[model samples]
Target: MSHLVSNAATDKISPTLPLTTDQKRLVDQILAFTTAHVNETGPAVFTVYGDAGTGKSVILAHLFNQLQTASRTRPDSPLAKTTNYFLVNHPEILKVYREIAGKEPHLLKKDFQRPTSLINQLAKGITTADVLVIDEAHLLLSQPDHYNNFYGENQLSSLLAAAKVIILVFDETQVLRMKSFWTEKRLEHLLAHYPHQHVRLTHQFRMQASDELVAWINDFTHSQVRPLPQSVGAQYDLRIFNDAEQMRRAIVTKNNQVGLSRVVSTSGYPSTLDGGKHYITEGHFHLPWDQYNYTSTPWAELPQTIDEVGSIYTCQGFDLNYVGLILGPPLTLSPQNQLEVHLDRYTDVEAFKRRADITDAQELTAIKKQLILNSVNVLMKRGVKGLYIYAHDAHLRQYLGAKAH
Candidate 1:
C-alpha cells in the first residue's frame, strides 16, 4: 500500500499531464459517445481494450481525474457529482479512496453478508453522479461461477443500474487464471447488453522504439498489428542464458552497469531444475504493483522496486528500459512439433482442490491448445529492448528455435 517513486523522472510526469494525441482522440470519442447517451437519458458503457503495458490504466486514471475535475468546476454540469470506484484487486483502492475523500469510506468487513448491497448503498449516495469509472473492469466481467462463488447474476449489473455513464478499462489478452469471470466471451457479452463504445489502445511508448515485444503480442492476439521484422533492424534483445548460475552472474554484472535492473521469472516462487532454476506462480510474473511479502533469499526484506523480481502480472502496467523474462512450465509439443503450453488451463477439479503441483492426469488432459497459444502470446510480448529466453525443456527449445531462427 506504500507508494514509492523509484526515479525523479517518473515524478516529473504528473498523473494529469496534457493528453497525448492517442489519449486526446480516445477522450474526444468517449465524450461524444457519453454525451449522446446522456442526452437520451439512458445508461451508456464504454469499454477500452489494449494489450498489457499499453497504458490502458494510465489512460483510465487520467480520464477519471479529468471527469472529476470537470464535475467540480461545474456543479450544475450534467456530468457533475460523478461517482467513481477504483476497485483494487485486494481492496487496495478502498484505502486510496479514503485518502482522496479525506474521510473514511465504507469498509467491507468479514461480517458483511451482502457485499453487493453495500455497493448498492454506496451507489445510492451518489445517485446524482453523472459518471462512474471502473478500473480493472475485467474482474467484474468474470464468469459468475469462478472463485468462491462471489460472482452472481452478472457482477456489474448493480453498478450499471446506478451510473449514467460507465467507463471500464481492461485488456482481454491478460487473463492468467480461469476464474470464469475473465473470458473473452464474457467481456463481449457484458458489453453487448449496452450500446457500448469500444476503444483499442495501440501505441506503446513504454519501451524503446526498437522493441518488438508489442508487435509480437499483437500477432499473438491475432491482431492486425505486426512486429517489426528483422529486416527493419527491430530485433528483440532477448537471450537465453546457459543456466541459473549464468543468469545470476549476468544479472550481477548488468546491475553494475545499469545501477540496478530486475530479474523476473514467469513462476511466482523459485523452483529447482536439473540445469536451471524455475519460479512458477498462478499469476503472471511482471506487474506494475509490488507483491506483499515477496522476498529474495539472503535478503530479509523484499526489494522495494518491482524491478527486482519482476513478474508479468506485477509488471503489466509498468515499463522498464530493459526486461529479462524467465519462461516457466506446462510446456508440451503440438502435433506439428511446435511448442504448446497452457499455463492456466489446468483441470477444474484439481485446481479447485488447490493442488500445488500441476501433475494430475485429468488436469493435463483438460489443457486447451488455445490457452497455450494465449500464454505464449502474453509471455513473448513483454520485453521492451531485449528478450532472454532460457528454455530448460528441449521440446520447447526446439519449437522456439524453429520460430526464432
Candidate 2:
C-alpha cells in the first residue's frame, strides 16, 4: 500500500505530551518494527492495550512526530517511504486536534480524520497513509460496516488491508455501544493473520486520586464489593451528594476557584427532556445533558460552557479538574443491597440499536447493564483532581455517602 501523501501533509506532526518510560519503550519497539517493515515490504500490527488514563494517546502523538521528523530530515532513510495519519472516532476529539493544529501551523498538513470519513475515502480509492494510528479503537465496529454504510465485513479487516503498519490503542472495557464492541477473541482472530505485538499499559495518570481510591472505583464499577479505605477517601476530594442541586453549586464553586470543572451524567432521563432545555431535574436540581450537535465544539474547553453539562460521549477522551457526575436512574441499589443496573431505564437508545435482535432476553439485559456500568466508570475517572457524584436513587446515594465518610 502506498502512503497517503495527503494525510501525511495535513498531519500536525508535534508531540503534545512527553511519554513515560513504558510508553517510550513501546514507541521505540513500534518504530523499529515499522522501519523493518518498510525495508522488507511486509505488514505489521501493534496493539497498545490500556484502561483510561494510561497515556496511550500521548505515546502515539509522540511517535507520529518522531516519524514525521525522520521522514523529512533523512529523505533516504526507511522512514521516507512511509506516511502517517491519526484517526479518532469522536468529533470532539477531532476538534481538539484541529485546534492543536491551529496553534502549530506546520501540523496543518497532517491529517486527523474521523473513522467513517476515512472509511468512505478508502472505499472511493483514496489511500490514507501507510501507517495509520487509531486512538479509542475500542469504538471500532467488529461486525459489518452497517453504521457507516460501507462495503466491508468490519473495520479491522479494512484497516489491515489499507495500511502496512496498523497501531491500535484499545480499551475493551470502554466499549459504549453494542454494534461497535469487539471481544478479545475477535481481536485475537484479527491479529492471527499478521505479525503483531501487544503492549499493556497499567499506570493511571489522568486522576490525581490515590491508588486505593482508584482500586475502589474499579471494584465498585465491576460489581466487586470492597470497603473504601478511610485514608484514601480523606486524601482525595470525593463527595457524595444527596441533593443534585447542592452538587451543582459545589461544581460551580470549584470551577470558579480552580477551573475546568463541569456537570456530567448518565442518560436516564429523555435526551430531549424539558425540550432539551432542562433535561435533568430533582428537587430544584435542573441541568441538561450535553447538546447532541455540540460535537464540533470543545464543550469542555470553552470558558463560557461552565453551565453546560456533558455525558460519557462528550467527555470520554478528555480530562477535567473536577467532575460532578449525576448517577441517574440507570444505576441503583437492589433490595439485596447489591448494585443494580436498570438497562431499560437508560435513555441512550441510540447505543442500544441492536436490542431487537436479542433472542435471549436475560443475556441481552446483562450486556446492556454492563454497558451502563462501563459508562459510569469512564465518567468517574475523568477528573484529575476530584470526583463529585449525585445519585438519583436514594439508596445508592446513601450507600455512596456512607462509603465516602
Candidate 3:
C-alpha cells in the first residue's frame, strides 16, 4: 500500500533544513528580492500562489531562515539589522512553527505569531517589523472579527500598512470560511494597486499520484463528478470503500504498519466547542471527532489521534502516510451524476456565518458550497501515499465502487 512518499519532513515546514531544488531556488529568489526592496518607501508584496503541497511553506521556511541569518549574524548582508516576523492564522500550524523555531539555532519562538497578535501589537506601538512573512494568508480575515479580537477592517490591508515588505503564501481553493473568503480575481484586484510580484507554482510536490489522478481530484472538488480513473491508485494507494467501518479498519492497519495515517472526514457529523466529544458514526464505525490537542505536538503526530476522526482544521497543511476519508452527509451524487454539496446537511455552522460584503442570496449560497468543497480538497490532499474514501450517499459510493475495482 505504500508509494514513494518520502518520510523525511520535506512537505512539512522544516525550519532547520532546506527542501528540494525548486524550493531552494524560490527561497533564494525571494530572499534576494526582499533584500533589495526592504528599504523601499512603499509597501511591497511577494506572493507565492499554489495548490496544497506545492512547497509554498517550504520555501517560506527557508526564506525566513535566510532572513534571520543575514539580519542577525552577517553585517555586510543587505538584510542586516532588519526586524522581521512570520505570521500564520491557524493555531495548530502556528504551534508547529513555534516548536520548530525553539529547536533551530537562528530562530526563536518569539519570531512567530498569529496574524491577529502581530496586528494588535503593531497597532499598540509595542512592536515594529520591517519585513513580514505570512503563511496561510488566505485565512486572513477580510472583515472585523470581534471574537478573535481583530478590530481591523482587513487583516491583509492592515499588515501591509504596518510593514515595509511582505511575503505570503495563498491558495484560494483552500479557503474554508466566509470570514476569509477569497478568489484569484479578488486577490488580483487587491494586489494590482500594491507593488506586488507573484509566482504560480504549478508542479505537484507532495502527492505521489499521477497527473490524471490529480486532475480527477480537482474535478471532483469543482463539483464535476466523473467515473473514477481506470486505475484506482496505480503507484498510489487510492481506493474507494463501500463501508466506512472497513475503511477505518484499513486505515488503522496502515497506521500500525507505516505511521502518520488516520481517518478524516468532511463536514456532516456534529462539531462543537463545548469541551466534549461528539462522535461520527457510520454503520459500526464510530469515533469521536478530533479533540482539542493542548500539548505541544500536532494532532496528527499524537499517538491517540488514530482513534479519532480528523476534521479539516486538524489536518490541513499536514502530511499523512495514508488517509481514510469519510465523505459525510453534506456531499452526494446528484441526479446529473455531478458532485454536489447539500448546505442544509452540513454540520459545521461556524463556517457558514454571514459576511457583510456578500449580499446576493445566490452568490452567498454558491460561496458557501465552495467553502465546503474547499475542506474536501484539504482533506483528500493530505495522504502522501494513499487516500481511501467512503461516501455516505449510497449512489455516490456505488458509482465510485463501479470504477474502483
Candidate 4:
C-alpha cells in the first residue's frame, strides 16, 4: 500500500481523512444547521459530541480550512463573511494551527491568577470573530469553578453577543483529563441554557470492526453491569514479547510488511531492568527531568521515551493502530493482594474514595488497578486486529486470566 503525503508537515504527526458515510450525514446536518443559522438575523451556537479519536479534531480542521478558503475566494459567501476562531486547550493545537496558517495571529495570554481577566480576554476576542469553534468543550464545562471563572457573568452570553456562529466540539466519554468539567448532565445543562443546535458524532472511524477494546470501554464507562459480546466488541490485537529485542524485531517485521511510515505508541521513557535496557517501539521517550515535574520532549526526537503508561486523561483524542503499553512499577500489585484502583483523575475526592476499594488502596496498588483497567481499555481499543499484554505482575495476569485473550 502506498502512503499518502500530507500537504503540511505537521499532518504527518497524525494525519486523518474526511468522515465516513454515517459521519458525512452528521456533518451534512451540522453544515445545514450552520448555513441556516448564518442566514438568520440572530447568533447561533452548534455543538458536536463524539467518542475519543472519533475524528472530532479532523472535522474541525477540515471545517476551518474549508471556511477559510471559501472566505478568501468568495468574499461575499456566507461562510466567507464569517471570521473563524478555533479555541482549544492544548498548546499543541495552537502550534499545529500556526504551522497551518503559516503565521501567528494575535495571542491573548491567559491569566490564571486573576480569573476575571481570563474571561474578559476570551470575551474580548469574540467581537473580531464571526464564528467561534471551541474544541474539547467537555473540559470547559467539567469544573464548576473553571466554569464560573470562564463563564462568570455569562461569558458565553458575551461571546454569543459578538459572534454570529459558535460551534462547540465535545466528547463526554473523553472527559478523563484533569481540570475537565465534562459530564452528561453538564452537557445537557449547557444545551438547555444556551439553546444551541446539538449534534452527536457516534460513528467511530478510528477503531476497526475487529477491535474489542471499544466494547470494554463502553462497559467500563457505563458500569460493568451490561453484557458485551466479543463479536461486536471493540478490541485490539496485543502481543507480549519477552524483552525489547523481541519488540524491536516484531516492529521491524510489521513495518517491513506495511511501510516505514508506520507509527507505534509507547512510554516516553527508558527503563533499566537489572543491567539490560528496555526501549519502547517508535516515538521518542523522555525521562522526567524531576519526579514532580510534568513535562517531556516530543515523541519524534526521542521516540523511545514517550510514556505509554499514560492515564485516560493523557490518552484522549489519540488513536494507535497498535498500542504496546508498558506496565510500570506504579501499576504493580501490593502485599494485600487486592485490586486497589486510583481515582485521582476525578476531582471529587469523596466520589473517588467511595468508588475506590479502600481495603487495599496503597498508592502503587491503586495505580496498578487503574492502570490495568485503563490500559486494557486503551491498549485493546488501539488495535484493529489484536491486543497484546505484558503484565510484570503475576497477580495481574491471574486477574486478567481468560479476559486477556
Best by lDDT: 3
Residues 239-346, model 2: lDDT tens digits: 888778888889889888777788999878868523446467878887666675454556776666677678888788777778999888977887677887787788
Off by over 4 Å in 3: 1-11, 16-18, 232-234, 402-405
lDDT of each: 0.48, 0.74, 0.85, 0.46
Please write out the lDDT profile of model 4 over residues 187-247, one tens digit for every residue.
5665575547776766556565433446555665343522334455333344554443344
Residue range 277-365, candidate 3, lDDT tens digits: 99999989999999778887788888888899999988888888899999999998877787878999998888987888899999999
Clashes of 1: 31
- State the displacement of the C-alpha of residue 102, model 3, in Å, after optimal TM-score superposition: 1.9
Candidates ranked, most accurate by TM-score first: 3, 2, 1, 4
The candidate maximizing TM-score is 3
Q: What would the per-residue lDDT of candidate 1 be over residues 1-405, giving only the tens digit for each residue?
A: 112223221221234445678777787687667656664554688888876556665566556555655555667765555444444332332223323333212221211112344354555583343466666565453334444435445556766665677777776555444442255566777568777878777765444433344565455344232323442124335555535444544554544454224455554244322344333332233233234322221111134453345554444333333445555555544546544445453322212233233467675444343433444455555444445555445554554452321
Off by over 4 Å in 1: 1-14, 35-41, 88-130, 144-151, 183-185, 209-213, 217-236, 249-260, 267-312, 333-336, 342-376, 398-405
Clashes of each: 31, 9, 0, 45
Better of 2 and 3 by lDDT: 3
Model 3, residue pairs in steric clash: none
